[model samples]
Target: MVRAPFLFALLAAAPASFAQQATLSNGTMHVQEGTTLRFTGPLQFTIGPAGALINDGLIDLGTQAVVVEPVGSPISGSGVEMAVTATDGPFNATAPGGLGLSLTTNTATGPITVTRGHLARVFPEGDPSIARWFRLEAPGGGSAPVDVVLSYDATELNGLSGSAIGLYQSTQEDGPWSSLASTNDAAQYTVSATLPAPWDFITAFDQDAPTASASLVARNGVEVWPTLTHGPLFIQVKDGAALEELDLFDGLGRLVTPAMHQRSSTFASMDLSGLANGPYFLRIGQRTTIKLRKE
Candidate 1:
């Protein structure tokens, strides 16, 4: 009986293995995440391979530092901890950075992007001290992790020489874009890119030139080269859209549908059930050979 009492005591004193977790909710708040976390909100905590901890309104989570692990950097398994010490009270939150990850209650002006995990590349919208333009080539699809090509237009205006371009993606448009591969020559270059995955939109930003845009129209790829004639471009997705009157042409040089008939531009689907499954061309206005295929 005496041994049994002692055994129970030992069990009670044993160090506990915990999956550190916390929370901040309701009234006045305090939060810590990774290693750089400190908040005045009621909802904040951290997590890892282990589990998480829930924190009440006010609680000291010890002096252990929190960290921000790079989502796509060399520190794969490593964690970046941010330490917070409250000798008296919580630390004030600094205005969040604009690039990469952003944390703030800033009023929303427009769309918010959630990307730019790597810190290697960053650019200011109009930083005279830096190169600010780049381009992208997604040959295969519109998402990422697949094959894609990147090409740099020109960063500086006056010197305007083509530089290396690499593929990049960002969850947030306002943040940094991830780099993929570099395509050297502008028009002649062709590469494959795994699309960024079911994003409402994919934008190509260049650090050297004003802008460049490429899009898929009717199964055909169309790139609007950023030049004095038509630079700083954006791609518009047209799906069964209607225009006043527009011309359409088949793949062959011969005009299947002429500009004259394109007035009020009604394009009924050309019946392809009778044709073999193969590549066809589409001609629009001055543009020609928009490769279309039926399968």
Candidate 2:
């Protein structure tokens, strides 16, 4: 009675963006039951205890952020689903960082299902500073009550004041968070949240400020490599710091490359092996942008 050899992967319906920081560190990433792993950004599923992640379909965590660690390796999806699309209209409230949520937004009124646990890691022991929680749940039988319009970047909320900017709710993910009931358009930084009927893991904390590490190349520590590579594509820049400007985009966002404006040193190697496989978007220096998958 031994059966454990069924692995499938079909995630190419167009819409798989990983703008830096993705670590699945081991193996076993079985997403083959219904097929759908539409990610847009932020991912970290280091399940090691034999490593296993059987997700059924639909895992669009577009607002970014996802962390599943060795919580004992248990992420079996019963048609597993999770979504985040709530970015409509004017949202550059003077933009500084963090505020680009999506999963193909039409201003979602649905798709927020995260049945059965395992997405944990807001800070599960290692705090790089703060801010690292991701959750979504609302698709079980009845399903209804997922109205989100959250947007934040009022200079990254440190200036607070959008009525304080809080909409935290949690059923325990190392959180006692409970604020929910929001609606602050503080000059269009946006915040309308409502998960009414017995909420299930929502996060947008700003108890005063601190949770906005908006990574302009991870705050200048910079390091980009093998983001699903096949050839040359490296950019280090840590203490050496010199590599300024570098642009290249494809995958509809256009801007094919031709903006290496000049100034390089701290280890830069971009020879994409001639480029022409799939996703691409790298805009280092003046405001980071990363997502390369030319394999």
Candidate 3:
């Protein structure tokens, strides 16, 4: 995915902010999870204890690679693999290392619109065997039913014939994963179910296969749209409370504090008294914020 914007308070607690590296006009810049962008320069976004930061060149991170994105540059990656090694930790990462996929663009001139309709999951954590857990959740704690269609590029791997693949969903990103869709072949799949509980879809491979090498796995490329959750509001939540705050930005993926949020479960209403009416994303986070547009 492209470098997104500020963090949503909801994402404040998540550790391990995945970093993405790409070169541009001004050297290398480090990026975190919800960073928004227009990098005419090289950037590497990394997330950790101190939070996410953008650096303008290659700094030696443990794993991962050094990707280059030149102006009008065509980006590509091969021998690309995610291997989750079986360790005594909470997650199992195997060979090839971790799962990962490169998010690129087809356009270079104007702004990019990436909605749930343009989400792609990159499993660069390597191979997740018997220990890969999945989770999902809706923004603003909005329990409204939304439909998300997830697809993956599995053409890079082989030997996954007859593998039982299914997607799981939930209101939270860490709970019992409910099955959304399933199949057994080599092709892109889609699910049309509504996640009333705020959800995410997980595609799983061989559940009990002993041979780790032959299990077929892939990343997610999904399209998500909130159905009954339509909005053109400005609001914020302050400890289970709803109020009006103006320090939010939208999908533009740039960082610049605007206003402040308050205590509200559904910060969906606001008064843009002095501001112009258009489209903006209400980004709430320590860094990676949830984006809601105001029109």
For model 1, the superposed segments whose C-alpha errors exceed 4 Å read: 1-65, 68-100, 106-116, 119-239, 243-295
Give the per-residue lDDT digits (tens) of candidate 3, residues 168-245: 333333322333333333344322233343334343333222222212222121111121122323333434433323
**TM-score comparison, 1 vs 3, better candidate:** 3
For candidate 1, write residues 1-295 as lDDT tens digits.
0111111111223223323323211222112233232333222232322222222222222333222212221111112212223222111221111111212222221222222121122322221211222122122222323223322212212233333232334444333333323343545432223433433212232333321223333322232111112112122224434432223222222234321311233332234344433323333333222333344
By TM-score rank, best first, the candidates go 3, 2, 1
Model 1 is weakest, by summed lDDT over 10 consecutive residues, at 1-10
Which candidate model has the greater lDDT, 1 or 3? Answer: 3
Per-candidate Cα lDDT values, in order, are 0.27, 0.47, 0.28
Q: Which regions of candidate 2 deviate over 4 angstroms?
A: 1-112, 115-162, 166-190, 193-202, 207-236, 239-295
Residue 248 shift from truth in candidate 1, angstroms: 25
Error of 2 at 55 (Å): 22
Distance from true position, residue 115, model 1, in Å?
6.3
> Which digits, one per residue and each the tens of the lDDT, describe model 2 over residues 200-238?
555454433322232223334677766656656777778
